[model samples]
Structure formats: C-alpha cells, structure tokens
Target chain A: MRLPYLLAGLSVAAVYLVLLHVGEGRQREAEEHAKQGHVTASYAQLGKAYALYHEGHWPLLDTRNRHFAYDLGIVPKGYAIKQEMEKDHAPQAVLFGKLGRHAALSLVPLVDFRNYFYLGFAVTTEEEGLALAKALRSGAALDRDIKVAQGTGTLGSSTLYRLHDDIVETLVMDGVLARQDLTLPGRIPVIVERPRDGYAWVVFLDMHVEHLRYPGPFPLTSKFVDTLESDAL
Target chain B: MLHERYDWLDQARGFVVLLLIVSMPTSEYAGDLLTGDPVLGPPMLNHGYEYFDGDPAITTFIDSGQALFLLVMGFVGYTAFTSRLRKRGKGAAFWYCARRVGVLYALASIDCVLLELATSGKPKWGDFFYNGTFAMIALGTLCAFLSIVVIPNADRRMLFSVGLIMLHSLLYAFPFFDHHTWYDNILALPKFPFGTLGMCAMAIAGSSFGQWHAMDPDNPRTGFRKRIVPVSTAAFVAAYCMDWVQPAQHHDSNAAMLLQAMYIGGFMLMIFFAFGEVGFRFPLLSSLGRNLLLMFALGGLFIGIYLDCFPKEFLLQSPYLALLLGGLAPIVILSCVAVFLDRRGIMVRA
Candidate 1:
C-alpha cells in the first residue's frame, strides 16, 4: 500500500515539473516569434502561453490593440479586458459595468491586480462638450459634496469634479442612444476642451472616485488629452 | 439506509452546500449593505464586488467550496458506480451514471433559465449550458466516470487525474477560449469547468479516495486516518508551495487548483472525524447533504424569490437585518425542506 501511494505521488510530481518546463518553453518561443515580426504566429504563441501560465504576462496586447483600435499605452501589457466589443462606429467596451454596456469609454482593468486604476473618456466637439459639461454640472439629484473644479490648476487644465461616495446620478449621453440611461457610482468627472487643427475638441473623463485616491495619481494630464485631440485621425 | 454508514459524507456535503448558497445568493445584497451609500435601495440594482476582481477572501472561499462540492460528488459517485457494476452489471452502471449526468445538466439548465427569468425577464436557450456550478459538475462527473472505466486501478487513476490537470493547464495556457461568454461554458467542449480540466481531475482524484474507503468499509476510520489524512496533508503542503511560487488568482492557476482540491480533501476528513465518527450529528448540514440536488434547486428558488420579491431598498434599509434575512433565509428554508424530506427517509438522487 505504502509503495503504491509513494509511486503515485512521485509520478504526479514528475509530470507537474515536466508541464512547467513545457509552459516556460512556450513562453520563450512566443518571445522568439514576436522578435521575428511573425505577428499572427506570435499572437498564437502568446495565446498558448496565456493558456499554460494562466496569470503569466504575455505580449498578446499588440495584436489586441490593433484589433480594437486602442492606443498602445491605453491597456497595459500583463492585463486584459473582456474581449466583447460593442457594435458601433467607434470601438467601445465596458469596464466593470453590468452586462457589457456602459455610457463611458473607460480603461479599467478587467481583472484586479497590483496598481489597479480606471481612465474613462468620451470625446466630442467643443460646442457639444461645453453643453454636455454644463448639463452634467447642473444634473438633477446632485450630491452635496460634489464639486466641479473650473478651469486648469494643479489638478490639470481640464474641468474636474468629484462626486460623493455611494452617490448614483443618471447622466444623459448625447448622440449615443444605447447609453442614455447611464448611471455611475461616485463618478469623478473631468473635461478637457482643446482647439485642434480643424475642429475644437472636448474630452470628458469619467473616473471612479474611490480608485482615484487609493492608487495615487494616474500618468495622465491635459497634455495627454491635447495629444488625443491632435492625434485623432 | 445505504448511505447511513457514511453520514459524515452527508454532513460534509451539507456544510459545503450551505457555504455556497450563503456566499453566492447574498453577494449582491451584501454588497449593498456593506457599501450602504447607494441611493434608491430597493428595486435599484447596484453592482456588487464580483469574485476574481481582486478580492482574495471571496475568491478563496468560492474556489475551495466549488472544488470540494465536486470532490464529494466524485467520492460518492465512485461508490455508487462500482456497487452498481457489481450488483447489476456494467451496462446498467454506465446508463445509471449517464442518466445522472443528464439530470444534473437538466437541473443546471432549469436553474439558469429560472434565475434569468426572475432577474432579466428574458431567457436565452444558450444559458442551458452556461459555466455554472451544476454544468461543471455534470461534466466533471462524466470525465470521472470515463476515467474510472479507463483506468480501473485506483493508484493509476489518481496519477491520471494529475496528468489531466496538467493537460488542462496546458490547454488553458492557449487563448482560444473566452470566459463568461456562451463559449466559456463546459458544453462548449474544451473550455472552463470542462475543458479547463481541473474540475474533472478533482472528481477523478476524489474517486480514488472512494476506492480506498470502499476497500475496508468496516474499518473506514482507520483507513482514512492512516492513508487519506497524511496523503492529503502532504499534497496540501506541496500545492501551497506551488501557489507561493506562482501566486495566481482564483482557481485558474494549476497551483490554486491543486491547493483547493487538497485543502477541501483535508476539510472533508476533518468533518468526517469531528462530526461523523464522534456521533455528534449536525442535522441541518446532514439533511442538506442527503438530498444535495434538491436542496440546490430549492436554495436557488428561495434566493430568486427573495430577490424578486424584496429588492435592495426594502432589504438595505436595515443593513444588518438585510444581511441576516438575505443570507439566512434560503439556508434555513432548505435545511427545513431537507430535514423534512430526510425524516421521511426520502433520498432523491440525480
């Protein structure tokens, strides 16, 4: 009996080690494929790496970003969002919203990990952005602690507002029919109005308030918003 | 009467069932109570802190409970299969097991459909095979049965399960499968809860222990103490070291899978000795355990009824009251139903 049990344990241990080696080899192969500019092949290898390691970071994001029309830095490597995409002219996915639909274009980590943060933005024309911002500031059932910061400051050159904790207010999404009934909890709203080459642009940033304080400052500023406005193709 | 000798198994099952129902049903309501700042308490839906979104505590609880449930299934199922094979014939046993898989899938479908009807007022037929607990259990049961048939020897089967988990890990490392979509469900064949391989491995591994227990039915306590306890402990320690090195979240990682299965194996042993051997009967738990499937359905029904009837506003007004009522209502009701059924010696299997 003891002999059988011992043998079984030993065999399991051996197999586990061998599988780990195989997983590591796959990871190395994925890197080699990536370096050789085998984009599709690299993606396939990285997909295998992801399946093997589960939580291990692989560079599948380059292809994912290209597929989703996301900026390279928008979603960090080693993190992924749910792959469900909204059927719209522009690429959009909900980050922590119910049933894969939300009013904001947010970059929130799908899975929780170290250095978790959220960045949501809705781009519009200057006239539309201003009118929308005005309506949001004067929205019905506003919380008392909510204060919308006017103009640029240490916070940034954009208009920023922090809603009180646990507060839920419905916001109207102009031109977007699907998100008309968008309600967010403890939303931190910001607007960056910038005049670019041909059109004036307004970028609305709707962030989760609690996340803003704990994870520290995001590597974002009015300059970045201006870059978005300038770089829009 | 046939199951009376291993009442500990029932008790362990009951305990896990209680844990699963309490944690799962009240998650949304508990979120409202704990995070009491949301306006429009009742009828308004406030998203709760979802599992696997970085909450270590909830993730550990869910993972362990889920693995343990399947482990119990494997243990109990092996005994049922072998006994039928001996008494009736191989064909009868196979069909018996096949019917069980079908019944469990049917239960899972009904549960999903009803819950969807209650919550969203629209039911998708695809939800019948969603990656819910029962669907996974059904698939795991199928795999375990097949493994048992293929690898007749107990030790080889145990080794086979370990290989199966590694295979699952290897498959999962690939990114073809999408979780939470219809494709993620076990019915999609080669996705999580089925294709993921861990759950099936758990069931097969559990059956090996069942083999051991059946070998010496008269002296099960001694056999369990001498063999199962130490082996599970060593596996637990080994799995822990693997997890320490890898630190993967939830049950996705190989380390987490092994750790959870062994951890629950040890927990079942503890429950067996503490409650089963000592003649210290916990009626509520054992009652829920005896008719696990029925209780599971009843628990889901009661929870659906509670959520549908009393929305967050009514519940969240008094958070403590809501927590107590929301968490305990299904548990208490199911225990009563289980006990009532058990008292009449009604054991509803499938």
Candidate 2:
C-alpha cells in the first residue's frame, strides 16, 4: 500500500517539477524580453508563465472556487477613493506606542507595480512637497552632511531623487532590509518627488536592486490617475 | 486500548509549548534590547526562532513552534478522535472535534482582540485571525475532522496528505502579484500559501503515524522504530530536496509543513525512546500537555498585557532586568497556572 502511494506521489512530484521548470523558463524569458525592451513579447511570456505555473481557479477539479487574486492585484474602488482622499492630507501621525504593534507605518494606501519596479504613494501638502523637493535639490550642492543625487530621468510626473545615505548603504550591505518579493534581487533605496493636484505627493519607488540606478520605463503616468479616478466612479 | 493516555506525548507537547511561550517574548523584546550590542547579542539570539517568511536560510522547522504543536496534535488528537469514533459513533466524534475547534477559534480570536486592544487601543476585526499558531491549530483540527469523516483509513490519510502537499507546492509557483506593501501579506486578506491547508496536511500525515502506534499498542515503541522512524526520515529527506527547488518558509509553503512535521516527529521519537520515563515523572509537562490551548491562549494574553504595561523602552533600560521580568516572569506565572490546573484534575482540551 505504501509502495503504491509512494509511486503515485513520485509521479505527481515529477509532474510538478516539470511544470515548475517550464513555468520558470517562461518567467526568465519574460524577464529577458523585458530587459531587451520587448514589452509585447515580455507580457506574452508573462501570461504563459501564469498559465503554466498558477493553478488559477483550480482547473484540475473544475472547482467553482477561484484562487484569490492577491491583495496587491485587486485595487478596489473604495481603497482607491481613500487613497485619493488621503493624497490631499498628511499621513495620520501614529502614536509612538502603536508604532511596532501594527504595520501602519509600512502600509501605503496606494501602490502600482510592473515587473521589478514598484511605485508607492504618500500624502503631503503641495507646499511641503515642493519645499522639500527644492530643499533636497539645493541641499545636494550646499549640504555636505547629506548626499542626494538627482536622477536625470523622470518617473511619470515626478522627479526622481536618488538618495545616497550611509545607513541605507550599510543596511543593503548587511542585507538588513527585506524585499517586497522574495524573488527580487537584493535591496536599494530610491525616492521620487511628485507634486500633483495642489499636493506634493512623495512618490516612492519600491525597488530592490543592488545599487540605485534609474529603473527602466516608469509606467505610473496620467493613465494611472485616470484608472484610479474612473475606478472610483 | 487506544484511549489510554501517553505521558511522553504530553511531555513532548509541554516542551514545545514552553518553547512557544518563551520564544514569543524573547523575539519581541530581547531582539530589540540586545540586537546591536557586540557582546550580548549574536550567538544568544542566533538560535532564537520566529514565524518567518521568504528567506530559506533562516526558515527552519525550529522557527515554527506552531507546526511542532500540530505535529503532536496530529498524533494524540487523531488517536483520541478514533477512540471516540469507535466508542461513541460518528455524531459524537464529530461533535467532540467541532467543539474543540470552536473553543480554539474563540481563544485565538480573543487573543488577537486583546493584543490589538492592548497595543492600538482598538480591536481590528480583520486581525482576529492573525494569531498564526491558534489559527493553524483550529483550522488544522477542523480539517482533521473532515478528513476523518471522509477518509478514515490511515493509508488513504497518508496519500491525501501527500497529494495536498504536492498541490500546495504547485500553488506557490505562480505568485505573480507583487507584494509591495505589508497589507499584501496580511493573513486576514486572501493570499497565496494558505497555511491552513498546510496545517491540515500536517495533521492528516501525523494521524497516519498515530495509526501505526494504535495498531500495536502493546509494542508501540517497536512499531515507531520500525515504521514511523524510517518513513519520517524519508519524508524529511524528500522535503529537504524539494525545499532546494523552492525555499520552504513556515506557513508559506506545504514543503515547510512536511519538513516541520518530520522534525517534530524525530524529536518526539527521541523523547519516547530515551527520556520516556523522565517525561512520565514531570507533572507540569502533563498539565501543560493536557491544557495546551488554555495555556497558549492565556500565555499570549499575559504577554500582550505585560508588553503594554511595561513597554520596550522601560525594558531596555536594564536589559538583564527586562530578560527576567519580560521573559521568565510569564513562564513562571504560566507554570503556576498549569500546575494548579493539574493538581485540581482539570484539563482544558481545546
């Protein structure tokens, strides 16, 4: 009896490995195409990767129950509306005692991601955002105490601010910071300054590269806003 | 014959629960207190455990005490379930298991709510399922009930366990959605690597071993050595091999559950063979083993209250003092409760 069960398990495991290898192969191809600037091909490969690897809707049993779309994928209208509302206001100051108890500090109400690149949003007044951005840009030249390299490329409507700090560098070196996705390559810190709708929204990129470099093809644009606004409707 | 209590099993469970009780406070407070100090931190905190994610190197069976508990429960719980089924019939057995699940669920919910209130001054309804150990146990028990009702045979239960784990392994391969925020990984929210299934698999697989012991109650140790030992060893090796293909993180993958179940099985086997008599003499172990759910729930509640009242800042002032008050104090208090309950012939099963 054990022998038969073992044989069956081995068979299933072999199939699982084959599927895994094929899925991973497609995923790698997708990444390669993405790097090569083949957006359509990359996306096509990604879809194939999903079909092979993901047991979407549990097709094996034709179970009516659907595999849950992860929280990051589904952007509910209410949450988007909340993000829009929060965009006009500063982040609610959490009490010191409540800091480590919950994930409130790490919770970004609005986010968008494509491949390895992630864009996170925080609410700040327009004046504060501009003043801070301006101060950072100016402070790079004057302030020897801090180092900030302004990136030449633009991230949608925002100006890319590449921050170089010893603490972050040490953290990256020591591998102290955890990546959002385990599959992502190491860790790096980058910040973007986006001023929009009478608010200086501090747009943060969720990149986990080895070193700070301009992430390729910033996709969060007017379309992102349009999508959110329309979804809110 | 199957209804007979196993002191060694209870002692092993007591040991696991003790680890759970200590590790929680130690990780929460001591990690912060002694993190950067050159002399006090490194090796002392090196073996310290957590309910980890993603990182394969740090993710071990040792990290998840919850998995250990489930493994033990898988044995005794299944044996007890079978005993009840034989004596009282299906309805009684199902009711017995259902009531246990309900109690566990209630305790887990209360623990989450109390901790939330302690920290944030308000209870977040969403966080009620955040307590991983309790949630896993409750759900695992429910799954065990279902599995027993549907596939009671030990051989089939083992097959079901293997199949579920295989499915679980495949499920994680396509986590296409980027978890960019902390909320994305929240247990309350729908996410990949639903650990309840993993726990269920662990319980079912565990019950297979329990069945072996039951088959030869007169010579259970011989049966354990002949059957459970080799099988567990093979499963452990298999799980380790599969883990290389995909890193096994606790509650994140079914492979991790298999690894942990084997790990705990091996540990319990060690206790059974060598220190079986030692465990039999330990009344506190017996008490803790019997009142597993009650102790765990109360321990968690006490930890929450202690953290809230004392706070980390106060604890940090004198790290050694904090270690004593924050860590040892709760264990001592819990031991007293366990002992008192034991002496009074009280056993809170759920």
TM-score versus the correct structure, for each prediction: 0.58, 0.61
Best-matching candidate per lDDT: 1
True contacts kept of each: 0.11, 0.14
Give one digit per residue, the lDDT tens place, for model 1 in B1-350: 22334677888878777766765454554443223335332221112224214322234445555676777788888888887887888998899898999998888767677767887887655446636667778888998888888988887897787667656555544433423321112222244543335677888888887776766778776657765676688667767765544333444535455555666676575666677666997878888888987877666556666657677777767876675666566667777888899999898986
Clashing pairs in 1: A50-B173, A51-B172, A51-B173, A51-B174, A52-B173, B41-B312, B41-B313, B42-B312, B42-B313
The models' CA-based lDDT, in order, is 0.53, 0.52
Per-residue lDDT tens digits for candidate 2, residues B140-181, read 777776777688787788778877877776665444422112
- Residue runs of model 2 more than 4 Å from their true location after superposition: A1-10, A23-233, B30-54, B113-132, B176-190, B251-254, B277-281, B307-323
- Give the C-alpha miss distance for residue B182 in model 1, angstroms: 17
